[model samples]
Target chain A: MMDFLTNDLLLLSDSAVRNAIPLLLACLAGLYSERAGIFDIGLEGKMLVAAFAAGAFSAIAGMPAYDGGWEMGAWSVWIGLGAAIIASTIFSMIHAFASITLRGNQLISGVAINFFAAGITVLIGQHWFRMGGQTPQLREGQRFEPISLPFAESLKDVPIVGDIYYQLISGHNIIVYFGFIIVALTWWVLYRTRFGLRMRAVGENPGAVDTAGISVVKLRYSALIITGILCGLAGAYLSLGTAAAGFGKDMTAGRGFIALAALIFAKWKPISAMGATLLFGMLEAIGNKYQTLDLGFVVLPGQFMQALPYILTVVILAGFVGKAIPPKAGGEPYVKER
Target chain B: MNKNLPKWVDLGLIPLLTLLLAFAVSGLVVLSIGQDPVEVVQVMIKGAFNPFGIGHTLYFTTSFIFTGLAVAVAFHARLFNIGGEGQAGIAGVGVALVMLSYDWPHWSIALLVGTLAALAFGAAWAAIPAYLQAKRGSHIVITTIMFNLIATAIIGYLVVGPMQGEGSQPQSERFPASASLPDFHEIFGWFGLEFAKHAPANISFFIALVAALLVWILIWKTRLGYEMRAFGHSEKAAVYAGISPLKITMIAMLISGALSGLMAVNTVQGEAERLLLGSVEGAGFIGIAVALMGRSHPVGVLLAAFLFGILTQGGAELQFELGIPAQMITVIQALIIMFTGSLENLVRMPMEKIFIRAGKGATS
Candidate 1:
């Protein structure tokens, strides 16, 4: 019984970690933009475009060097990552221009960006690949293959600790580790750096930041650029790091919104964002494992498990669990007073 | 600064110019995809307005009107109720359950009960989020979005588990024929007018128009409407005038959700005759574009919805004729929303300057 429980834990934890990476990255991306006073619901759109770009570029880059031959020498995954970042960054700039430059409604701009990304990606994908808005299946060279941590194999024979270390903590793609690094990096950037101070200040009170001689526009733009890059990583991970070999239509599947919910549940804190996303990821893993959860007395439907993250977010937002106060100047466009 | 500009310019000329800019950018998108922009436009126009296509266009317009009104009503209360998609979806289930519950004797009785069921279910779906936003100060935008996903999950569960039909498909059993709404052919036949037989345009089109008229009166002529607009414009001021934020928010969202639910009358009962998964098909999101283009006015919504109806039908035609993907219309819709809603300043600034100068010269 003990061994069975441990094995199940090991399996569930492994899949949980994999599921959390994209949410972690995107949640952190939203943290940057929203903390800088630009409310971005377009994170989904940017990530989707990036996923498509990553999938397409990787496939093209990994094409055989010689006719009628398969080659695995191409560093196509890295190229795909680069393309994803560029495409997402350009898409984010459109949001910036509308919300920041034009002084428009941020929500409207975000909605438009989401639709624009959804449409353009599919249209371009169908035009180029003709496989019903899906990119070609990526080869091994085109995907971010899993890497075993040092001593993982050596530690595999010990006891429960070894199994946990070998199975749950190691053998993930580079992006998974990068996602953890990003959480710490995001904390360092937001709390410990001078730029982070101004960004936070801008979200709370842009007029105060402007009075301090920092250009609010420049700060907001830089924050959005960071947001775009983070979302790009998340999107690329979806297509390359996961079992999904190529970008499929609407493949993000509301994960972006779940990440948004996680952001709110975390109360916009980086460390808490990690915890919130992992919890949601664990829920997803369990949902994937079983169609219905039997808890001795009643069977809970799988859909309830799938929707737990969103429901928790609503609970948190409603202050039933805790208060989630957004930044004071979060959605308002700042205009300099003469 | 240019308050002296005529209302026509503010309401009419500006949106027109913005739409033109959006179309120009869409043309570039078409060119990027290696399609002729001119030919695409011609084909779309021909497809949307052709004898058989007009019926389909009107059919789409009916749904757009309901969703557009839903968004507009919430906008009046300064609530961004993005849950219209989910509200409409859940309402489809409500519609299906009611219509499938009994074998009704007439379409009129079924339509009446279905509309009520739709309104009740959609409003019920919105109530939790509305309550959260009202009492707890939660953000309506995020809550509405979350509700949309939750609604999707609930609908998915129902269609597959409890509400599944006899077949393997993920949809409920078909409603009885007595519950089916009259199509355009039968309606026009009553007036001795020639109309296409298979058109999905039904009496629901008239219901949508009546709903629009009711919305106009509710927004422009009622005390609640005045209070709602005042609350939207300035919550603190509205509070000073004894308006309750909770009351306004709850009422606005319930009405908005009901308007959104009315759309199921067209898609579920009128057309599909069954509740199919993904029946909403992004019409709720398109409502945002329509409301933005329409300036939240009833007349403007009607026109904007008709325009979108053309694009939707024409898009299908493009898919069939030119091999262009249907997503092309979505791109156009996004551009329209971006230009009219977010980038209005690009046109308004220049136009305001011109108007100010012209006004000064005329006064001199």
Candidate 2:
């Protein structure tokens, strides 16, 4: 019973980290955009489009040489990642133009972006691949392969510490490590850097930032660019880094919204965002592990587990769990004083 | 800055121009895909207006009407009710529960109770988000999005577990024959008019029309509507005048949610005769596009809903005839939303400039 429990713990923790990477990246992406007073509900859309771009480009680049076909090197994944970043950044620019330049409703602009991504990805995917809106299955050389740490194999039999290090802390694709690095980078950028300070100030008081000789539009645009790049990484992770062969239609599902929930649960803090996403990820891991988990007294349904993150977000938003105050000028477009 | 143009410019001309821009962009997309834009349009119109296709078009129009009205009602109070999708989905379960409870003796009685069930369930789904927004200052958009996901999980659990049919599908058993709503074929047959036998359009279409009429009256002809509009315009000003923001928010959302719920009567009780998973099929999101393009007016919503209904039915035909994906419609819908909802200023600014110049020339 003890051995089985330990084994289950290792497996669960391993999957939890894997699942949390995309959410973490997206959550941090939201952090950058929302901090700059550009509320982005389109994170899911950006990630989805990026996923499609990455999958499609990588599949094309990695296609083997035939009578007339061109073969590419294993560096195809980098090309795919670059395509994802470029596509997502262009998509984010649309939101920036609508919400910033046109001074339109930010929420409505975000909604449009989401719908646009959802539609365009599938339309282009089907047009290119003709696989019913799915990219071709990526092979080993075409996708991100997991990298085992140097001591992971030797450390596997070294009792609890070694097992924990081997199972929970090692053998992940490069993006997973990048996700953690981004959490740290995000913390540094949001709290430490001068640009970060101005970005936060813009979200809280664009008028003040404008008065202080900073261009609110430039700050907001730059913030959204960062948001776009991070979302692209998250999307690439979903398609190229994960076990899934390639991008499928609507594959981002609701992770964007879930990341938004995590952002709120963290009260816009970076470290807490990690914790919140990990908790949600663990819930997802548990749900995937058991169809219906049987306890001594009651059986917990998987649906309940799946719904818990959303329920918790509502509770937090309602101040039952805790108060979640957003940035003051979060959803409003800035107009210069007349 | 120019406010000298007639109301028709704002109401009619701007939306028309915006729609044209959206269609132009969509045409470019189609052209990029190697399909002739003119041919695509021809096929779409023929497919949506043919005798057999008109019924499906009207059927789609009925649901769009309800969801569109739902979003429009909330828009009056400045509340973005994104939870229409979830509210409608949960309402399907409520409708199934009521229709499956017992053998009702008549279709009229079942229809009445089923509508009430839909209204109650949809309102209940919206209630939490509304309450949070009212009392706690939570952002309604985020909360509604979360509720949509949760509602999906709840419906998935119910349909697969307790509500599963014997045929191994994740759907409930069909409601009793007596509980089925009258289709357009039967209703038109009573008047000696031959309608398509398999068209899904039904008496629920009439319900949607009635709902639209009632919404018009409620929004334009009532004291509550005045207060809701006051709150929507400016919360600070409304509060100074003793209009309660909380009251307006809650009432507007409840009404909005009920309208969304009413859509289930068309899909679950009228067309499918059973509660199927994914019955809403993104109609809730489509409501946002409808409301935006309609300028949040009931009559405008009706027209927009009909237009979207044609796009939907026509897109299905495009898929069948031209090998183009049905998502082509979604792309068009998204463009419309972006242009009409978010980028209205793009056309409005230029048009306002032109109109101002024209008005000045006449005066000079």
Q: Is the docking of candidate 2 incorrect, acceptable, medium or high quality?
A: high
lDDT of 1 by residue, B1-364 (tens): 1367788899989999999999999999999889999999999999999888999999999999999999999999899989999999999999999999999899999999999998998888888899999999899999999999999999999989989888999998999999999999999999999888898899999999999999999999999999999999999999999999999999999999999998998999999999888989999899999998999999999999999999999999999999999999999999999999999999998888999889899999
DockQ for model 2 equals 0.81
What digit string (tens of lDDT, one per residue) describes model 2 on residues B1-364?
2368768898889999999999999999999888999999999999999989999999999999999999999999999999999999999999999999988899999999999999999999999899889999888998899999999999999889998888889899999999999998999999999899889999999999999999998889999988988888899999999998889999999999999999999999999999898999989999999999888999899999999999999999999999999889889999999999889999998888999899899999
The candidate that wins on lDDT is: 1
Going through the candidates in order, what is chain B's TM-score? 0.98, 0.97
lDDT value, residue B180 of candidate 1: 93
Residue pairs with clashing backbones, model 1: none
Q: Per-residue lDDT of A1-338 in model 1, one digit per residue for the tens?
A: 87775788789988999999999999999999999999989889989999999998888788776632234345888888998999999988998998899999999998898899889989999988889899889888899988999999999987888888899998999999999999999999999999999999999999989998999999999999999999999999999888898999888888888988999999999999999999999999999999999999999999999999999999899997879999889889999999
Show model 2 residue runs off by greater than 4 Å: A65-70, B1-3, B357-364
Best by DockQ: 1
Tens-digit lDDT track for model 2 on A55-93?
988888888776222366687787789889988899889
Model 1, residue B243: distance off in Å is 1.6
